[model samples]
Target chain A: MRQFFGWLSLVVLMVFLVIGALFIMRPFGEPPSVMDDYIIDNAQEEAASNNVVAAVLFDYRGFDTLGEATVLFAAVTGALLVLRASHKKEET
Target chain B: MSKIVRTVANQLILFVVIFGLYVIIQGHVTPGGGFQGGAIIASGAVLLIVASGSQEIKTWLRERRLSVVESSGALLFILLAFAGIGTVFFFNFLVGSRLFGGIPSVGPNPGDVWTGGVIPLMNLGVGLKVMAGLSAVVLALALFSGGEELEE
Candidate 1:
């Protein structure tokens, strides 16, 4: 079941990525994005950060960054738990 | 593995650590951000583990401390994110205020260190979390393999 789900997820990711590439991948050099323009123009004034990328990650798109952080935290917790559980099983 | 390798690692570790810190601390004003900086720092830790055997490292680098630091970093990042709840989930409230805040002129120029408000703080939390989490993984694998070898 686990292996099946893992493969299924990979397939899903590939499917989405392929679909996204076909429809959403912007052209090289000249892309269609007003959001990028806004971030670059007003990031320093609004977020007061010199690095526009940093401002975008931490301020403009913070929820996404938070989710990424949460994912890493959960991964570490799961790894430690599994390692400890295996050690306990050995002891018992 | 040998004396020469160990000596080289010992000398290079300090420089790696300092560079990582610079990346993390100046993330808001520099090219490198939290994740990049954290990975760099973790590389240094991995180098140390490789230079010295995991058994010897276990004496100085406690698993409990790594767990604590990792948890704290995650907590700090979340806490900082939540603190801007008044306006939004991650609002930059300290733009004009005096708490690690300094508004810079709009557009390209040399950036200020005491600016970027919560960004620098978030970078710090993320850097710590990544450093601890990665180091913990390497340490755990090393320790577990060491145990297996002993059992054999």
Candidate 2:
């Protein structure tokens, strides 16, 4: 009885997700291009980099990269901490 | 690991490091970037570990050293971002200076290595961070499984 309800809920959630995606998402390759067009056209001249993607990542949207680096730092720190604790436990 | 596997990994690591650096340095003019290049170098580290085990690898590629490299990379990245703060945060202040400030001719042309301003430097910093961070994690995991701990 509970299994039936679970399956029904899963199906209903999947249906809702699919419907939402269909309605909310734009078609492929047709993203909102107001900013994209501007970046594509001006990135080279402004950032002085040939690769627009690199320019966008490091120049225009640098804060995002900084945030990403912070996340990586935190994750590595956490992993090292957890792994190092094992040796401390064994020694004591 | 067999002797042949070890020899092959050793020989392949040189090319891997070269190619990863090429990808990272040319990131401003090509499809690849810091993350991709760093991943390639980390794969080289993984190759060494798999061929020789982490015990043999730990003598040089210690966890403490890797942590330092990661910190340096993060520091360089943030410092470069802060350097431009006189104008605005994250400004491309090197756009027209003499260092890496050559403005490439508009439209499709051969890409210049010295034309990326701060982008290439940023790539280098990110590449170092990713390479060290991943290699350290892998080494830590291998060490833990081998009933060892990273040197303090």
Candidate 3:
């Protein structure tokens, strides 16, 4: 009886998840075209780089890229430290 | 499944690595760039690891060598970026220029293999960084999985 209720709740959650996904994907009456044009016009001036995508990623939105690099460095450092610690424990 | 299939797969991986290098080298004018090509090249290494053994891969990824390669690549990238600033940042330093003037502009032709100032160097740096980082990640995961057996 408890298992049955648990399964029923899971099914209900899944249905809600599907509905939420659909809501997010559903297009409005018209798509906004202005944003794309704005991006192209300003991208070069702000970044000053030839490759538009690289300029966007490394120059215009550099802070975000910095944050991302920091996160990656942190993760790598943590993993290396953890492994070193485990090796030390084994040796002792 | 069979030995023949495994051999064929290994040959296919070899072909992919060569093709990936071709893409990376021609990235300036071509569709594929360093990151995409690097990842594909790294995938070939991964295929070797999977087909072979961890010990073999470990031998290939000598810790000191990988660390040196990764560090040097990063340093090179920084230096290249700084070179732009050093040149007053008026124009991109690394982009190739036509040698219209005899002694003054006597350099590699624009859009040539050696052109695109720091782009090729940047690509080389990115390739090293990605390959070493990915190898390190795979090594860590392998170690983790190997350690799991001891737990049980």
Candidate 4:
């Protein structure tokens, strides 16, 4: 039956997804030590903020932060507009 | 499944709210900051709305002047940031000598309430924004879920 084949395909796809996730998470080897030290030493001054995480998020990688804020703003705006439209439809 | 669980949950929500505020106040010296603390505090408001009726919550929100509080917080933040720029960009604006020597103009003492340059102000701005936005979301959801007839 068509339903049986559809269910079979879904199961196959789920299995492949699980396998892909496992492969990506598997650790291959140890990372370099120098990289860690470099990050720790230069984190504060380069970021120019007291909060280290804020520094990383807003200063060290400002472009990424801008993108993130834009995305969030867009999402919130979309949600608000959608809800407003629904309310208007209901009233009419 | 009984009255006891409901009481306990209510008590837990209160404790979480107080702890969240503690985190917000001690943010500069501790791991948590304004965002985490504000979110947690907002959760307390959410708990009240969920546990209590929406009409009661709406009455409380309007009576408390929360919107005005939020607006003032935002305005203060912008003014503080402007002060930094007015001094000079990246010139230790917050803690530098005065131009006319009328007052030392040295920034607040380190670790003082007024310290941290614009950080505290920014935190306040973030807090207000989060509080207001969450309030709006919760109110909207409450209205929608109550199934009240819409007024044009």
Query: Relative to the unseen true structure, what is the C-alpha lDDT of residue B142 in candidate 2, on a scale of 0 to 100?
Result: 87
Q: Which residues of candidate 2, in runs, are more than 4 Å off?
A: A1-33, B147-152
Pairwise lDDT winner, candidates 1 and 3: 1
- Report iRMS values in order: 1.3, 1.0, 6.7, 6.4
The TM-score each candidate achieves on chain A is 0.66, 0.65, 0.58, 0.56
Error of 2 at A5 (Å): 31
In model 3, the Cα lDDT at residue B85 comes to 70
lDDT of 2 at B1: 79
**Most accurate candidate by DockQ:** 2
TM-score per model over all chains: 0.82, 0.84, 0.60, 0.55
Docking class of 3: incorrect
Sort order, TM-score high to low:
2, 1, 3, 4
The regions of model 1 sitting more than 4 angstroms off are: A1-33, B147-152
Candidate 1 clashes between residue pairs 3 or more apart in a chain or in different chains = none
Model 3 chain B weakest lDDT span, ten residues long: B100-109
Per-residue lDDT over A1-92 for candidate 1, one digit per residue giving the tens place of the 0 to 100 score? 99999999999999999998888777778877898888877888888888888999989999898888888888878888877777677778
The superposed Cα distance between candidate 1 and the true structure at residue B8, in angstroms, equals: 1.9
User: What CAPRI grade goes to candidate 4?
Assistant: incorrect
In candidate 3 the C-alpha lDDT for residue B39 amounts to 71
Highest lDDT scorer? 2
lDDT of 4 by residue, A1-92 (tens): 99999999999999999999998774767564565476456643342334555434433343453354345335544555566668678888
**Which has the higher lDDT value, candidate number 2 or candidate number 4?**
2
